[model samples]
Target: MAASQKPDNVAAVMKVFAILEGLAAQPSIGLSELSQRSLTSKSTAYRFLQTMKELGYVSQEEESEKYALTFKLFELGGAALEHVELIPLANVEMRKLSEQTHEAIHLGALDEDSQHIVYLHKYDSQFNLCMNSRVGRRSPVYSTSMGKTLLAWMDDNRAQEILAKTHFIARTRYTLTSAQQVLDELPGIRQEGVAEDREEAELGVRCLSVPVFDRFGQAIAALSLSFPVVRYEEQKRDEYMALLFDAGKRISSGLGFYDYPFSRS
Candidate 1:
């Protein structure tokens, strides 16, 4: 970034960036309102808006008198999404896993921009294991087993940052609201290569997930299976865990992990 002539500081950059983010967060933003909400002088705000307009980042609305973002961001992001190769590479494998276990299977990657679990595909279970969940939907990273599987594998500093921003809302009674407990389980989850949610997101819904790595040895996403909690009582719990681990291993191997580093078969 060019050093600004005007005695640059974090506060100044934050204010300016907040305005841009505010506009991006919503569909449109107006001139006077953007200045007030961003807590910046009208002249300074207008100058930045004009700069954004020239850079093809923001556009003016004729009737609403609002500014909206352009396609510049997506043009940058879409390229990376295409390169992941999980959509085509993992689709058939996900279907096979779902069929094998008679439970729903999902493929998700941590969306860096949103810090949420972005579902790539959701293979329907034989008898509908939680029909409520949708493909392309995002769940909080700290709330889902599929999310925690990846989060637990991350380094401490990165995990702390994630937990700091994470809201940890108890979607159901079983949800982990305390980061301390979740952090405590990181080591075991990392060692075992599997994570579980016993009715955490919703009542009677249990899920088990294991991490899927990329060629770069990064935990890119997780392969998960979900079933009703009642069905997983006692002896059945081990079976469910095994099924998720086996499928996760297959998916990870297909993604270029010749040998899954954790939880041997």
Candidate 2:
């Protein structure tokens, strides 16, 4: 490709994706709405839509004269996801977090049957006094940061159902010892897009976690950073949250979720 033609090619590619995103955002839309949403002229948008329709990636409702995406994207996405192994994909992001924070990093998933967070992968902290945990260790959902994160992003009824079964054992003085207490805190966790274990799961250990989503936008896993209270700096809470959220977003994206439901800023 010639350097002089690159800008036009890039702009054309952007326009196509923008139109595709616009269509994906709603059930269907007329050309005018799509053109405005995509920041392209009607003629350009229509031309792109026609090309996509011919390619079987888009469909046009004859009665409404509206454009919408076909299941082609879903088919493509499903094929891609089929080849992706979750733990290895997560390890790339987890390793980066482990290096950056030098803390115990964990990847956990909800074990719904047991109502616990199962550690899928972990990186032990470089410090000798780090959190002692291993892959496959199960921790109560009511007391751990990763567990709370998984619950926070879940549907309220489903979350409540899981909470109802929880024994709510007080692992420490900080633990929330009731289902209602955990339920009350879930909204705040969702709003903040993070969860905290303030020595609740274990005395003298503090952990922060963020949810990791899949293509269906379900919170399938959580990424967490753990530190002993002696090593955890209160002032660096924001920095720690940022790192965890970043890793969560990256891992979620790898799982085919483009929209990470959290404010980066």
Candidate 3:
């Protein structure tokens, strides 16, 4: 067997990982020094470096013949960190909403591939009859308040691209059945810093949502409150909106975004 593939194939894996660690320890590295640090043959180190470069994890300085780590690793790490940070921050606010309103509370994020808002965390209403949803369940973007809130904060073209891919199945008579219908409402929703689903996704359920922002001030998720039509009071709309906005602001602030656009109640 080739030396690079020796030691039950673990040595080659360890060698490449060592090379990555060595590359990370400095801005850039030459093949000879990287090989020396990783304790691998120059040939093996070069092969692994070439593979990492092709995979977009490493870049080479043409003039100096040195290899450097790329932003790709940072991008992956940032995505992981965003999810990790979002849930705990959201949980704190979600618990508060649950106690205050005794209504279904949800934290949702966009799933572009599915063209839906995925419930990331949720608190069931205290009542026996309430909105039916759970964590990991997906809902149509064009009809759900959390979905609309997420899209409203996104770039117009990107939001349109996602809308174009959506199947737009009408889950209820009130559901908006076209992309243009949903698109037209996004501007107003964004302007108000909130969105609503008035019996759109379900017959008896109404929902209100506010955007959750990240450190970059980008809306990365949405927080929502759900009420049954029989239990909902028109006069309490403002009260529910206030609760959602308060939770959203605290969650966003915890995520490093201090300027949550809406006024507090």
Q: TM-scores for all candidates?
A: 0.67, 0.68, 0.77
lDDT digits (tens) for residues 1-265 of candidate 1: 5434545676577766878777877889888888888878888888888888898888999898798888986776764674357667677677777777777888887886535888888887678445467878898877788888888877888888888877768888878897787788788888777888778877888888888777667787788888776566667656666766666667677767767775534
1-265 per-residue lDDT for model 2 (tens digits): 6534679879899899999999989998999999999999999998999999999999989899998899999987964464346788889998999899888999888773748988989899998898889888999999999988888888899889888877777889999999899899899999998899999999999999999888889888888999999999989888888887788888888888989976558
Model 2 C-alpha lDDT versus the unseen true structure: 0.87
Record all residue pairs in model 3 with backbone atoms less than 3 Å apart, i.e. clashing: none
Q: Compare candidates 2 and 3 on TM-score and give the better one.
A: 3
User: What are the lDDT figures for the candidates, one per model?
Assistant: 0.77, 0.87, 0.90
- Pairs of colliding residues, candidate 2: none
Of 1 and 2, the candidate ranking higher by lDDT:
2
TM-score of 2: 0.68
Best by lDDT: 3
Worst 10 residues of 3 by lDDT: 1-10
lDDT of 1: 0.77
Worst 10 residues of 2 by lDDT: 78-87
Off by over 4 Å in 3: 1-69, 112-114
Shift of residue 59 alpha carbon in model 2, Å: 36
